[model samples]
Target: MTAGAIAAEPLGVACPMDLGWRYASGAAMERFLAGLRERRIEALRCDGCGRRYLPPRPLCGDCRLPLDRWVPVAAAGTLEAWSVYRLPILDGRTGEPRPTPYGIGLVRLDGADTTINHLLAETDPGRLRIGLRVRAVWREELRGALDDILHFEVAR
Candidate 1:
């Protein structure tokens, strides 16, 4: 064994480790992603309070109702708020910092009261504005994933 491996052996650890799978996954997650792949979006609704949520959930936190029903959302949405991210964040899938100088926004998709946070493609800080119309840029292959809609762009 190499010296590094010998050192790690003392601690009951592997020299080269896979620091993966630090995530939280629940039952509703699969269905939630499936809808995105199918070009549909689903949100949970609180039957008691009449509130609708996007990215469906098992239960409403506020009203405590079992959330079911697949709802379709428009590809286009309104930008409620946005900001240019100077600091990079690790892209969960790639385990690398996302491309620098990107935009992130809270988009209030049509038919859903809650806004979904996603990457905005247009990097220019000046062009991004609140309430701007934005649309999804879909991937060529549908894989039932949020990345299926690669990113949102300013609607022309």
Candidate 2:
């Protein structure tokens, strides 16, 4: 036994993880994504407080009440916040690191009470600002996933 810190060989092996699993997006989210596939936007309206939730959930977080009211939300919205990633980040879908200098934004859609977080097409900070108008750019072939929205671009 050596004096001071005697590091033991770490008992571990490095290997690529290849696994698959299924998860439920739940009823509310299922409906929401379905709308996206059709290039439609919808939100859950709270009966108690009247707050509309994007990425519709089963209940209102503020009132703790069941949210079943589906209301049409505008395709365009006001940008409430934004960020530019100067560092490359891993793409969760591809499991690969993607080049950076991309923009992301929080948008408060008209007629909706809450903001939806999504990627922004405008990477130039000079072109991005709070309250900038943005609209979803849909894919040519729509799949019922959030990425069906290519990204929100600054509306002309």
Best by TM-score: 2
| Candidate 1 Cα lDDT to native | 0.81
Each prediction's total of clashing residue pairs, residues at least 3 apart in sequence or on different chains, is 2, 0
* Model 2 weakest lDDT span, ten residues long: 1-10
Write model 1 residue lDDT over 34-143, tens digit each, in one string.
77777877676677776778767788887777977556668889999999888878776676787689789999988787898998998898898998999988999999
lDDT of 2 at 14: 88
| Per-residue lDDT of 72 in model 1 | 62
Q: Can you give the TM-score per candidate against the true fold?
A: 0.78, 0.89
TM-score of 2: 0.89
Judge candidate 1 at residue 8 and give its lDDT.
44
